[model samples]
Target chain A: MKFSDFICSKAIRHELSAPDKEGVIRELTGALVAAGEIAEEDLESIVGAILKREELGSTGIGRGVAVPHTKHPSVEKLVGTVGVCADGIDFTALDGENVELFFLLVSPPDRPGDHLRALENISRQLRDDMFCKFLKQAKSAEDIQTLLDEADGDQFGP
Target chain B: MNPSEANKTVVVKNPKGLHLRPAGVLAQLAAAYDSEITLTKDGLTVDARSILDLLTLVATQGSELTVAASGSDAQQAVEALSHFIANDESDEEE
Candidate 1:
């Protein structure tokens, strides 16, 4: 799955200002709501679910990334947004490093396939050092989206 | 010429498959050893030291994967990862 397949382009943010993990989750989830990708009424629940998932274990999978995700009945479809915090947020990741790239995902409880495929795409695409480097360097939302576009176009490795 | 490698096949017991949390745990455990570790699902294999590579397999619950490691500490690395996947419990499966 490509970023276009699930990522809401309108929801992507660059230079995120949220200073903490919980703030970042709420910030990114709010972006989805503002972008009209998810229901405004479901914002609190989605944020709560993602936070709860974080409690189980930080989604900060290391290498300066965090994929905060949860399966929620409130979302009929898989919705995702990206946030780049140049300053980084302490995620208590497995590597115990701060995270700069945040991919917050909320999917319907029933569609495990879409959720898995989205994650597969993210991980596969992130393996490319150039892609990861360029994404972290992106100064604007369009720049990030362009990179995602390039990644989807096969400009990067599998 | 190469050092002996350690390998074992383990069944994924968590109903949710090797999703984020477990994959993260498996990656951390693999990284603890000096050995290089890999997990193979079906015919696809990925570096067990990276949560990213591990997630790519999308190995579902009930799937069988082979954990392979090579280095002086291969056996210990392989055993730890395989056991974790095989015995991952009920609470976290959800």
Candidate 2:
């Protein structure tokens, strides 16, 4: 469940321009669409599904991060993208903090295990404060991907 | 277990298991008490207060988990957490 296993590198956004939660989600999903990881036609439906998930409860797990996700029939497997909103977006999170790091995931409805493992892996890696800091400071998509690559390699101390 | 520590094993009931919503709710509930609590599945244990740690449990439906707490509120904490884990399946989809 390494980040590389599911995250669409080309879809990564180091500086998100969205000003709110829905905007950020749409932004990241659009990136996935642009990267060819998800179908262009599926964008709105996927965004709607992810927003519906948010209505159940905010995916903002706190520590200035949110892992917005949904299971959709549109994706053949798991596909995810990262977006950094350096300014933060209000997510109504459990910790009552705005979110800056967004990890949005869309996966096939049938693959619950992969979804869970991806969540677990993301949580495990994000637990490292240095990783979050570096991710927040990433200045470009390539820089963000490099950090993710290093995270996958266990370069950041846990 | 000491008198100050409480533990109970529970079987997950949510058909979707402990996905983000359920895990998030459980973590929020666990945060309500002063006791240090943990949820264990198989051999892996996580801080009950952390959604991140709870996610790592990846406790799918039918998974058995142990709820353990230590503090003055241990008994009540264990009771509430186990009850939530065993009976709460309201996260089922439309």
Candidate 3:
């Protein structure tokens, strides 16, 4: 799926100011709350759930990618955010590398299929080395979206 | 992938087959188990443990695929996974 399908402009953080895991999560999830996709009161719980899921297993699949996801009852539909950290962060990837591209996914607990499908969509597209390189170099939200748009066209279909 | 689980293989008998949709379904069932699940296709082995990894296999229509799970519940995994593969309805969810 393209960025247009799931990622809103607010969800795309071109220049993340957060320096650590908690900081980065707060920064990304706060945008989701501001965009009205999540409730202000639910932000802490959402982030907590995501952290807890990470404790179970690192979503960092390596190759400069991390897909942190959790299914919560508070969410009624599949929602996600994408953050590009050009400065890089220590995400403890399976391949023992840092992470620069992060996809945070929150889905309704009832919709496992939707969650998997969304993750599958992202993971499959990220498999393209050239696309990942382009995304890593993207400097603006529009640039990131454009890369995703082109990658979506090339990888999935037009 | 162990051959003990290897003996238990199922073909994509569903009319719609194990395309993106059905593969997603199989992946879901596979995830519920604690075992390491691996799907083999055309000599390539994918971590059935991961829905994303399973999708990478891209099992198409009438593709011959094998789903093997090894862990505490390997037998249950094989039973449930085989059932999931065999029960093929185009609109099935989860």
Candidate 4:
């Protein structure tokens, strides 16, 4: 699925104030809640679920990117957001490098296919070094949304 | 000395196909060898060492993947990865 399909502009954050992994997740999850995508009562449980997934293994896939995701009962459909942390955070990445890009996904427990597709789309776009470079430099939510649009249009090359 | 190259086509046997978690395991297995490994499906080839690249393949159940490897350990890498893809049963979770 296309990132623009589920990654709402209101959920995009250019500067993640959190300096660590947990805080980063909290900040991003909080963004989704604030945007009315997820209920406030479910916030703690959703963040906890994502954190438990982290315990299985850090979602940090290296190359300054992390896809922290979980299949939750709180959401009836797939919901996600993109956050950039210019200063980077130690996510215990497989590559042992700090992560600057975060793509947090929360999907219903029944839609495994959607979750995988989302991850696939995000990774596919982030694989482009130029896209990652521009995403890292984005200073506003509008800039990040614009980049996603351009990347989805194949402006970055195959 | 030049390294040997090996290629084999294997069917994804996991009920869920080569999804994210299995792809991660496959990538980790490929990374342990010295060979330059890749998987090709539908004319798209991706580095076997990269989980992200592997995920893009979206090799759903029953899909065929051509596993190719070239290096001193080419034969072993291809054989092991092919076998893992074709017969592994530890794909339930994690």
Q: Native-contact recovery for every candidate?
A: 0.59, 0.57, 0.11, 0.30
The weakest ten consecutive residues by lDDT in model 1 chain A span: A108-117
Could you report the Cα RMSD, in angstroms, for every candidate shown? 2.1, 2.0, 7.8, 1.9
Off by over 4 Å in 3: A155-158, B1-52, B55-94
Question: Candidate 1 - CAPRI tier?
Answer: medium
Predicted structure 4: lDDT: 0.88
- Candidate 4 chain B weakest ten by summed lDDT: B85-94
DockQ agreement of candidate 3 with the native complex: 0.13
Against the true structure, candidate 3 has what lDDT?
Answer: 0.71
lDDT of 1 by residue, A1-158 (tens): 88888899999999898889999999999999999988899889888888888999889887899999988887788889888988888999877888999888888886767877888889998889898888988999999999999999989975
Q: Rank by lDDT, highest first.
A: 2, 4, 1, 3
Candidate 2 lDDT by residue in tens digits, A94-148: 7899998999999887687888889988998988999999998888999999999
Grade the docking of candidate 2: medium
* DockQ of each candidate, alpha-carbon based: 0.60, 0.58, 0.13, 0.49
Under CAPRI classification, how is model 4 graded? acceptable
Say which candidate scores most in lDDT: 2
How does model 2 score by TM-score?
Answer: 0.95
TM-score (chain A only) for the predictions, listed in order: 0.97, 0.97, 0.92, 0.98
Q: In order, what lDDT does every prediction score?
A: 0.87, 0.88, 0.71, 0.88
**Residue-wise lDDT of candidate 4 within B1-94, one digit each (tens)?**
4699999999988766676667877889999999999999999999999988988887877889999999999999999999989986563432
Deviating ranges (above 4 Å) for candidate 1: B1-3
State the lDDT at B91 in candidate 3. Answer: 45
TM-score of each model, in listed order = 0.92, 0.95, 0.68, 0.92
